[model samples]
Target: EADIYQTPRYLVIGTGKKITLECSQTMGHDKMYWYQQDPGMELHLIHYSYGVNSTEKGDLSSESTVSRIRTEHFPLTLESARPSHTSQYLCASSEGGAGEKLFFGSGTQLSVL
Candidate 1:
């Protein structure tokens, strides 16, 4: 099983409020990723980090940003939250290499009111 974790499992916030979604893992994986999804919809990769201090934006367009300062942690930040930003944020980690399976966290559901 994956040892990843995400905080504030659910959040309700006002428009324009800044928020940070936290993700961490104990598996010592060097590759981490963030995906955005709506309920009952397909997940889209929004951000990723290959290792500490290396961050990259994913194929999907997102207003959120991310940072990777430690091997075990990757966090996503929304500078100005909006109702359109309301969605589920999932964190995942994987052992580096092609065809490696990703281990996902419980996920964070955010609502901007």
Candidate 2:
């Protein structure tokens, strides 16, 4: 089993509205990441953290930013969400490579109007 969490399994919001997608972990892992995906789509790394005090944006960004809100809460914040931001945001954490398999919880499928 994986030790990760997310809320609002699904959400529908109008354009220009702000929303925060919550993520948390209990495994005490130092590495955390956020991947965006859709049904039948690939998981693209959108954000990640190497440790508690470090944070960086990923290679991709339609419109998503995440803060190490806390060691356990790596919530994604969208200053202004649009329909294009409508998709799935997944939160994950790992210890290292090789044995580091991605553990995912049910993603938050967002629909912006």
Among all candidates shown, the one with the greatest TM-score: 1
For model 2 the TM-score comes to: 0.90
Give all candidates' CA lDDT scores.
0.93, 0.82
Once fitted onto the true fold, the runs of candidate 1 whose alpha carbons sit more than 4 angstroms away are none
How high is each candidate's TM-score?
Answer: 0.95, 0.90
| Weakest ten-residue segment in model 1 by summed lDDT | 96-105
lDDT of each residue in 1-113, candidate 1, tens digit only:
54999998999999999999999999999999999989788999999999999999989999899999999999999999999999999999999842598999989999999
**Candidate number of the best lDDT:** 1
**lDDT of predicted model 2:** 0.82
1-113: candidate 2 lDDT, tens digit per residue: 54788998989999999999998888777778888898898888899888776788887765777777567778888999888888888888887631587666678889999
